[model samples]
Target: MIDALHTHRPRIVVIGGGTGLPVILKNLKNRHVDIAAIVTVADDGGSSGILRNYINVVPPGDIRNVMVALSDLPQLELDLFQYRFKSSDQFFAGHAIGNLIIAALSEKRGGIFDAVQILSKMMKVDGHIYPAANEPLELNAEFSDGTQMSGESEITAAGKLIKRVWVETNDDSHKPEAVQQVVDAIMNADQIVLGPGSLFTSILPNLMIENVGDALKRTTADIVYICNIMTQKGETENFTEADHVRVLNQHLGMNFINTVLVNMKEVPPAYIDHKKWNEVSQPVKHDFAGLRAMGCRVISADFLELKDRGAFHNGQEVADELLNLIGRSPDEE
Candidate 1:
């Protein structure tokens, strides 16, 4: 809402976390779109997990990446911010400078939301970066075997078929809440994007928030889901395009998505280096008929980009398609 000059441009709210969210945001930052990112805070892994444990702050890894993606800072400054301490530094090993800064800012500002907003200004971010909820969230999941697990890392490590996922705070009495800005962004957006990340851990954790889910359900914007290029081992091992959509609808208790961006380019058999891509199992299967049956307007293209023997969404191509979709509103049609 602070971005007054771009008021005339299409407003987009991109929601999710992990490496994928940043890729999409980087692609969209230069475009003439008004962008706001709602990132997940359920992470309990890596440098973020360490800092969160020690400082009692919301996980900063996803938020840091998202901020960098939208930032207009010079390459060297950004690199310095992203720099991690060496393994030899026992006290600060593996912590990104940006994560530490965010942790300190969170303490100073009294919460993660304001810390990010202030940093957005400091970093000259081209878009708004809002944590999905103000507080740190714990992701809990129920697997098909009728077993339950807590923590994002543990759930993925279990490698069990997930039945459902939800979020809560460590303090049982205090429920996590989305800030007013996040709700307003979703409600007023011209286009809303979900995923290209882990369906359960990265994306669903945000939507499971009550206010966020309500905003998604009531928003007038055309909701679009960017399905992942590959199946995540513990998340969606054999998921088809429709299966991805089905999980979203199931979680939200509504068929809210209007369109699905699917990758049409096939991955050559034995092409992906599994050792390099530890989390990926295989290319996501296509189910055009299934997607149509669920009332989705499917947009299939060669949205794939293979690099270092790994599959990913071509960010520029995906961003262009999103712009084209948002441009032709129902009223215009």
Candidate 2:
């Protein structure tokens, strides 16, 4: 067994946003690795969209969730932070307490990046959380039919087959940039994890940033993608594991990923409640040969979990796979 005390904490950089990012982080926090999560800022939906439009602040909804995931706060405190105002409450309807706190701090501290840092210290977050970019980004997607749409929500709602997606300023002028810390984290990481989130919206939005993508390509760290178990409607309706990696490679113009963690257990048909799990409604078809052709060291396992009848990753299992990778040298892998 590896001695927890004497061994250096392996530096891990997780790049993605959306619900799945937090699930993995929640599990990883209990382990010894030093984690830094780089979250996408291209969101334009729900409370995040409302807040971003009203204040031009980096959408705090995703960041807030990531913070709570890594926080060592008491259950009651976390509940209070996650509490959302009722729709009947006209002024604060649909706003999470943590979202408001983050937005307020963003204003007081000059940006969301600083707001997250201040909040991290207060919340006793187990790892670093950095927004993919300091400014609000607009996600732009071109459909396989050669038409395009902007905004994360719009791109998904458009529902066409996405040929590719990229990020730009909300105004379509200046290119968004990540802070130095974000770059440094990627460059120095022992392992890099990409998604278990929306392929185009949650994961790629972060990489769409010129510097972040460039850093990912240049980094010597082992790039491991946690492939999602299900296919998302409007985004990845019929995507295979290889298709996911293919799009990622096409976007960055290089196949830098070293490994892929995929689910071996199959999600049962008629098991998913479409009303609740409408976004990602089907199991992702496996393509082992294709993945091998892409030069990925694939680690397939029974990584499925059912919550409220909805399929999700078994976070503990996935984190174990990541930890095992951290233990092995490139030659051994």
lDDT of each: 0.92, 0.89
- Model 1 backbone overlap count: 0
lDDT of 2: 0.89
> TM-score of predicted model 2?
0.96
Report RMSD for candidate 2. 3.0
Best by lDDT: 1
Among all windows of ten consecutive residues in candidate 2, which has the lowest summed lDDT? 324-333
TM-score of each: 0.96, 0.96
Each prediction's Cα RMSD? 3.5, 3.0
lDDT of 2 at 109: 87
Q: Give the TM-score of candidate 1.
A: 0.96
Model 1 Cα lDDT, one tens digit per residue, 179-281 = 9999999999988999789999999999999999999999988899999999998999999999999999999998998999999998876779999898998
RMSD of 1: 3.5
Question: What stretches of model 2 exceed 4 Å from their correct place?
Answer: 1-6, 328-333
